[model samples]
Target chain A: MIDIHNLDIDMGRARVVSNLTARFETGRLHAIIGPNGAGKTSLLKAVCGLLPSATGAIRLDGHDLTALSLRERARLMAYLPQERAIAWDLKAIEVVALGCADLSGEDSLKHAQQQLEVMGLSDKAETSVFSLSGGQRARVLLARLLATEAKIYCLDEPLTALDPAWQRRVLEVFKSRAAQGRTIIVSLHDIGLAAQFADDLWVLDHGRLVANGEPEAALSDEVLRQVFNITGTFAEGRNLRIDPQALPEHGA
Target chain B: MRVKSLSLAGGLLISGLVLMGALLIVGDVPLSGADYIEAITHPQSLNGEIVWGIRLPRNLCAWGVGAMLGVAGAVMQGLLRNPLAEPGILGVSSGAGLGASVAIVLGVGLVPFAVEASALLVSLMMSAVLMAFVARFPDRQALILLGVGISSLCGALMALVFNLSPSPVTTTEILGWLMGSVENRSWQDAALCVAGLAVAVGLVPRLRAGLRLLTLGEETAQSMGVNIRHVTLIGVITASVLAGLSVAVAGIIGFVGLAAPHFVRALGLRDPYGVIWPSGLAGGVMVLMADGLIRVMPASGDIRLGVLTSLIGAPLFALIAYKSAKSWA
Candidate 1:
C-alpha cells in the first residue's frame, strides 16, 4: 500500500500539486484522471520520489520513503515517465537490462529476458529500439518497467501513443501485474479507458483531489461535469464509452 | 557480440602498435626493418637512444591523446545523450587553448609543467560553467546551443589574445600551437597524456553502469537508483581532464573524439560500456595513423597534425550531421 499525505509539489515557477492526500491500496489498478494541468503527473512524480514535495510523507507499507536510500526506494517503487526517451539505438534486451541498475549478476540478463517475454517483446529482443514502431516502443519501455519487479509502480500516461489493440494488451498486462499483488498507479487521459480497466479512480481538478473511490462511483456524470466540466453519459460496453452532450461553461 | 567487439578492440590495438613500429623506423633518419630490430635487441646502440628519446615518446603522445579524446567523447555523448557532444564542440578544448595562450603570453610555459597545469585548470572551470548553464535548461537543443555559444566565446577570446600579441614571433608561436602538432614533443609531454589516459581507464568501469542508466535520461535514471548529478559531474570533469591533457600535449586535435565513438557504434557496439574501450583503441589508431601519414608525406613544409585530423574529421562530421539531421529536427 502507498499513502501520500499533504503532498504539495512546486515546479520552480508555480505549485503544480497542492494539499493532495490519498491512500492507494495494494493489488489494484488505480487511475488518476484529470483535465489538462490537473497535476496528475506531478502527484505521481512526488509519490515516486522523483519530485521533492514541500509538505508530504509518502509511505510504502507504513515506511516513509524519504527515510530510505535511493537504492532502497528504487527497490520498492519504479517510475516510467511519459516521454519515449530511447536516445540511443540500444538493443531491445539491453534497454530492458538497464532496469536492473542495482543488480549485477548473470541473473539480471535472465530476469530482463523473462520480462521481455511477458511483454511479448521476446522476438524483437535483438532488434534496436529506435526501429520499433511507436506502439512497440511503448511495450519495450513497459518491459523495462516490469523488469524492475518493484512493489509499487508510478506510470504517467503509459498508453498515450498506443493504438486500441495495444491499449487493451497493455491494460491486460497491468491487470495481471495487479493480480500478483503489485500496486499500480497510472495517470491516464482517456476517461472511458479508465472507467473500464481502473479498479479505482482519483479525479483531480486544478491540483485538488476531487473524487477518490471505485471507478463506477467516482466517474459519474456529476463528478465529470464538476471536475472536467463535460456533461456526458457514461455508457458501458466492450469499451466504456463517454457520450458527451455539452460543456457546462461556468469556468474551466 | 561482446566477443566480436573485443576482437575488434584487439585488432585496433595491434594496428596501433604496428603503426608505432613503422613510425619508429621511417622518420627523417630512415632505418631498415632489420636495423630497427637490431636497435630493439641491442639497447646500448645509438639508435636505441633515438628510439627511446624521440620516436617512442612522440608515438606514445599521439596514442595517449587519441585514447583520451575518444574515451572522453564517448562519456560526454553518453552523459548528454547527444552525438555531437565532443569537448571541442562544448568549448572545453577552446578553453584549454585560451589557457595555453595565457601561459605563452605570460611566459609561464617557460616554467616546466605550468602550461598543462593551467590548461587543465581552465578547461575544468569552463566545463563546470557550461554544466551549470546546462542544468538551468537541461534539454537537448538547449545544450547544443549553449555549447555553441560558449565555444564561440572562447574562440573569440583566443583571437583577441592573438591580436594583442606584442610581437610577430609571439603571434607565430601561438598560431603554431593552435595548429596542433605532436612534432618534437618530449617525454614530459607524453607523460601528461599517459596520466590522463590512466585516470580515464580507472574511471571507465565505474562510469559504465552510470552512463548506461544516464542514456535513459536524468529523471528515468534517478528512478533507477542512479545519482544523476553525481554521474554528470564525474563524467564532465573526466572528459574535461582528458581533453585538457590532450590539448596540453598535442595541441587542439579535433574530430577524433567525435568520430571514434561513431566509428565504434557503426561497427556494431551498441552498449555504452561496450563502446568505451573499443572507442579508445579506435581513437588511438586514428591519431597514430594521422601522425604517421604526415611523417611519411614528402610535403614542402611540415604538415600540421591538427590540420590532417580536421581535414578528415570535418567531412565525417558533415556526414554525421546529414545522417542525424532528422533526429535533431
Candidate 2:
C-alpha cells in the first residue's frame, strides 16, 4: 500500500504538484487524468521517489518514504517515464538485463526472459533497441519494468504515441498485472480510454486534484465543467464515457 | 558478447607484438631476420645495444601510447556520454601540446624524464581548471560549451607557439611533436605511458557504477546512490592523465580511442569494463598500424602519426554520425 498526504512540491518557485493527498492499495489500476497543465506526471514522480516533496508524508506500508534508500524504493516501486532515450545500441536482451541488476543469478535472467516472452518480444531478443519502432521500444521497456517484478508500477504518459491496438494491448497488460496484486498508477490523457478501463480515476487541474473516485463519480459533467471548463455530458457505459457535444449555436 | 569477439583483443595484442618486431626489423639499419634474432640472443654484440635501445624502446612506446590513448578516449566518451568527446575536447591534449611546444622553442630541456612529466602536469592543470568551470554550470550543454571554449584557447596558444618559433629546426621539431610522432622515444618515455595507462585502466572499473548510471543523466545517477561529483572528477582526471601521457610520448595521436570502442560497441559489447581491455588492445594495434604506414610510406618527409589516426578516426566518426542520424530520424 502507498499513501501520500498533503504533498507540496516546489521546483524553482513553480508548484508542479501542490497539496495533493491520495491513497493507493495493491491489486488495483489507478489512472491519473487531468487537463494540460495538471500535475499528474509530477504526482506520480513524487510517489515513485523520483521527485522530492516539500511538505507532507509519503509512507510505504507505514514506513516513511524518506527513510528508504533509492535501491530500496526501486525494489518496491518500478517507474517508467514518458520518454526514453537509450543512447547506445544495446541488444534487447541486455536492455532487459539492466532491470534485473538488483536481483541475482539464473532466477533473474529466467524471470526477465519470461517477461520478454509474455510481452511478445522474445523473438527480438538479440536485436538492438535502435532497431525497434516506437511502440516496440515502449513494450520492450515495459518488459524491462515487468522484469523488476516490483509491488508497484508508476508510469507517466505511457500511451502518448501508441496506436490504438498498442493502447489496448498495454492497458490489458496493466490489467493483468493489477489483477495479480500489483498496484499500477498511470497518468493518461485519453479520457474515453480512461473511462473504459481505469478502476479509479483522479482528475487534476493546475497542480491540484479536483476530483477522486470511481470513473462515474469523478468524471461527472458538473466536475468536468467546473474543473476542466469543458461543456461535455457524461454517458453511462460499462465505465463512464464523455459524450462531448458541439458548442451552442447562440455562442457564435 | 561472443567469445570470438573478445578474442579479437587477444589477436590485436599479437599483432602489436609482430608490428613491434617489424618496427625493429625495417629501420635504417637493415638487419636480416636471423641477424635480428642473434642480437637478442647475443647481447654482448653492438647490434644488441642498437636493437634493445633504439627499436625495442620505440616499439614499446608505440604500444604504450596506443593503449593509453585508446583507454583514455573510451573513458572520456563514456563519462561525457558523447562520442565526439575526448580528453583533448576539454583542452588537456592541446594544453600538453602547448607545454611541449613552449619547452621546445625556449630551449627548455624537456628531455627524457622532465618533458613527459611537465606535459602531464600542464594537461592535468588544464583539466582541473575545466572541471572548476564545469562545476559552476548546472547542465551538460553548458559544460560542453566551456570545454569547447577551453579547447579553442589552448589551440590558439598552440598556433601562437608555431608562429613565434625562431628557427626552422625548432619549428619542425615542434610540428612533429604536436602532430604526433614516436621517433627517438626512449624506454623512460614508454614507462611513463605504461604507468599512466595502468593507473587509468585500474581505476575505471571502480567508476563502472557511475559510468553505467551516468547514461541516465546526472540527476538520475545521483539519485541512484552514485556520488556524481566524485565519479566524474576521478574519471576525467584519469582520462586526462592517460591522454597527457600519450601526447608526452607520441605527440597527439587521435582516433584510436574513439574508433576502437565504437567498433567494439558496434560488435555488441555492452559492459564498459569488458570494452576497456579490448579497446586498449585494439587501440595499440590501430596506432601501431598507422605508425607502420608512416615508416613504409615512400615519402620524403615523415607523415605524422596524428594525421594518420585522424585519417582513420575521422572517417569512422562520420560513418557513425551518418548511421545514427538515419536511425534517429
Among the candidates, what TM-score does chain A have in each? 0.93, 0.91
In model 1, the runs with Cα more than 4 Å from the true position are: A102-106, A233-241, A250-252, B33-38, B41-45, B108-114, B124-150, B327-329
Clashes of 1: 0
What's the true lDDT of residue B91 in model 2? 68
lDDT of 1 by residue, A1-252 (tens): 988898888888788888989999999999999999999988888887887645688898999988888889888889999887887898888889888765665677788889889878889998899889888888888999998989888899999778888887888899889999999999999887888889899999888998989877887768877787776555655245555557777554
How far out, in Å, is residue A211 in model 1? 0.4
Write candidate 2's Cα lDDT for B222-321 as tens digits.
4445566677777767777788788878888877778877766765675654676777777888887887777778871467889988988888889988
C-alpha RMSD between model 1 and the true structure: 2.6
lDDT (Cα) of model 1: 0.83
Clashes of each: 0, 0
DockQ comparisons of all candidates to the true complex? 0.74, 0.31
Q: Can you write out model 1's per-residue Cα lDDT over B1-329, one digit (the tens) per residue? A: 56878798999999989988778875788777676777789866877767877888889989988999998898878877878778676678888888888778777767876766777777878888866865555554665677678779888988898888878888877877877988778889888988888888777777776788776777788888877666766676678778878898888998999999999999888777678788888999999999988888989156799999999999999999998997668
Once model 1 is optimally superposed onto the true structure by TM-score, how far is the C-alpha of residue B207 displaced, in angstroms? 1.8
Taken in order, the candidates have interface RMSDs of: 1.0, 3.1
